[model samples]
Target: MSATRPPMTAVGADRLRDELEYLKRVKRPEIVAAVAEARAHGDLKENAEYHAAREMHGFNEGRINELEAALSNSEIIDTERLAVAPRIVFGAIVDLVDLDSEAEVTYQIVGDLEADIKKNLIAVSSPIARALIGKNEGDEFDFVAPNGTKTYEIKGVRYK
Candidate 1:
């Protein structure tokens, strides 16, 4: 991991914590039981059930460790505590209008871990997010999307 801490929204951090808890408290025990059951019926040389159960156990443990590391290395940012600002910023919900198509869309600037395009959550380091940052409501700017260059007008910017 880099020495610099990666930024994560408070909500994202909470979600990771919940997943970690579930893996440790629920999934881990379940996998352990499955492995034990498989072991009881196992032949040492060619035990498919035992091998499958062990593979699942390894995957689950790896995920648990990944979640733990992510939580520990992240800088959790709380959007609710941020002072409401007119300019777009990290964790800000921004409303934008495509200049050519006149289509309106909403996006929340979030950390990499929490970014889900389907959910309108854009990563802070994304091309659009980088363009959106520091822009105020009604500001229009050109963005070089993968498709082509497009202009977008900031319709609104809210911290929460």
Candidate 2:
């Protein structure tokens, strides 16, 4: 059997692609120039600018490699193209009500790379997302959080 690739949203994959393009086409060349210019100035031993440029180059290359690998191993799921499903799944924008706080919040279940709590995007592997998975609207589930266990009721699920 083939290995299971990580599920990533189409938006996430596109963003990574854009970043990779910028790093390779723009950042890499800028770093190369900086390093060359630094090297031209003086001796190699005590050149702080030269070392900094080399470090920046290394970081840029490492990020490029990481993005390339991640993109290669990802399965991009376009929520806009998928039919709406009953259960909360990847690419689902979940509307939930906190049992304790009585607060309503919306979160999109996304890949780890796309998760940002501030933006209301939760990773599929996250505790809340894990508990929310396979659950339908009006269903309640308890999930373990960093603070404590919390209960939430699924209010709605939308693909877009």
Candidate 3:
């Protein structure tokens, strides 16, 4: 059987591609040069510089592999091109309001790798995103978070 592809937003896929490119074109070469320079300094076992460079190289390679795998097994979805009215799905941007605080927030429901709370991009697996899923505009729902349960109102939903 073929490997199942994980869902990914177009933006998330592009970010991963950019990161993979940077690691391969910039970081990989920089680490290789550092390792070479360190190797020129004599003994291998006791050389701290050499060991550190090797460790960093390993990390860089690991990240490259990880990005490659993620990209390979990903099903990228472009929300902007979607003809249907955005109804809180993967790649849709949702606007929400906190019922208690009356504060407003916007979040883009994205893939696991693209989840960055700082950027207001939430993973589909996250509690808030799960709660928001399948919800229509102006819909109210209760979400049970780690802190406690909170009520949220769906102010709007946009595909783009």
**Cα lDDT of all candidates, in order?**
0.90, 0.91, 0.89
Residue 134 Cα positional deviation in candidate 3, in Å, after optimal superposition: 0.7
Root-mean-square deviation of candidate 3: 1.3
Give all TM-scores, in the order shown: 0.90, 0.94, 0.95
TM-score of 2: 0.94
Model 3 stretches astray by more than 4 angstroms: 1-3
> Over the stretch 1-160, how does candidate 1's per-residue lDDT look in tens digits?
6487888899878888998999999999999999899889858458888888899999999999999888888889999888757887789999899999999999999989778999999999999999998888989999998899999999888875
Candidate with best lDDT: 2
Candidate with the larger TM-score of 2 and 3: 3
lDDT of 3 by residue, 1-160 (tens): 8876778999889999999999999999999999999999999999999999999999999999999999988899988887554467778788889999999999998999889999999988888888888888888999887888889999888887
**Cα shift from native, residue 63, model 3 (Å):** 0.4
Q: Tell me, what's the RMSD of every candidate? A: 2.1, 1.2, 1.3
Model 1 global lDDT (CA atoms, 0 to 1): 0.90
What lDDT would candidate 2 get against the real structure?
Answer: 0.91
Clashing residue pairs found in predicted model 2: none
| Model 1 misplaced stretches (Cα beyond 4 Å) | none
Pairs with backbone N, CA or C atoms under 3 Å apart (clashes), candidate 3: none
lDDT of 1 at 134: 88
